[model samples]
Target: MLIAKVYITLKKGILDPQGKAVKGALYSLGYEEVKEVRVGKYIELTFEDGDLSLLKDKVDEMCKKILTNPIIEDYTFEIVEG
Candidate 1:
């Protein structure tokens, strides 16, 4: 089996209101060292044995078409055998 671990995040220069809000709340709670924070998404995909090339292509396509906005977000993924 193979597991796909994906990490998605807002692109640099994009405003992340939720991250800012969380940071503010943390500061109020005495975690002042929190200089900045950014919220993102993590996704895991599990698949049976298959061609690695095809799997990578399909996952990349899915990320581009449905998982993230290419203009405002960046994503990375790794495939691990399990």
Candidate 2:
């Protein structure tokens, strides 16, 4: 089987309100050294093994079409034996 591990995050220069909230919460909790926090998404998909190149293409397409917002987010994925 094949497994795809996808990570999606906001592109640089984009506002990250959720990350800001988390940072604020951490500060309130006295984790004062926390300089920055960025929130992201991790997704795992399991499927039958096939051509690695084709699968990678499909995963990239999926990320662009649905998993991430190309205009404001970026994604990277890795395929592994599962």
Candidate 3:
């Protein structure tokens, strides 16, 4: 089997309202040292093993097509044996 660890996040310069809200809450809760927060998505996927190159390509296609938004979000992934 193969394991994929994917992370999706907003692109730089994009406003993250959720992150800002959480940061504000943290500051109000006495966590004054907290400067900023950026919320993102983490996905773990398992799949059957095939040709390594083909598998990598397919995962990339999945990321571009369904896993992340091309306009405002970016993603990175790592593949490892499971």
Candidate 4:
């Protein structure tokens, strides 16, 4: 079996209003040291054993097609085998 950890985030130069809100809330709650906050998504996936290369390719395709929006977001994943 293999485990995949995926991270999805907005591309650079994209505005993140939710992150900004969180930063503001933190600052109001006495977290003045907080500078910027960016929100992202994390996903964990498990797959049956297969060729590592093929598994990686499938995961990449899944990320591009469904896990993230190609125009507004970027994603990367790490695969762990067991």
How high is each candidate's TM-score?
0.88, 0.91, 0.87, 0.89
Question: In model 4, how large is the Cα lDDT of residue 51?
Answer: 89
Tens digit of per-residue lDDT, candidate 2, span 1-82: 9999999999988999999999999999999999988899999999897999999999999998999999999999999999
What does the lDDT read for residue 77 in candidate 2?
94
Cα lDDT tens digits, model 1, 1-82, are 9999999999998999999999999999999998899999999999998999999999999999998899999999999897
Decreasing TM-score order of the candidates: 2, 4, 1, 3
Go through the candidates in order and give the C-alpha RMSD of each one to the true structure: 1.3, 1.1, 1.3, 1.3
Residue pairs with backbone overlap in model 2: none
- Residue 77, candidate 4: Cα error in Å is 0.7
- Candidate 4 runs further than 4 Å off: none
Stretches of model 3 off by over 4 angstroms after superposition: none
Maximum-TM-score candidate:
2
Please estimate how well model 2 matches the true structure, expressed as its whole-model Cα lDDT. 0.95
Worst 10 residues of 1 by lDDT: 73-82
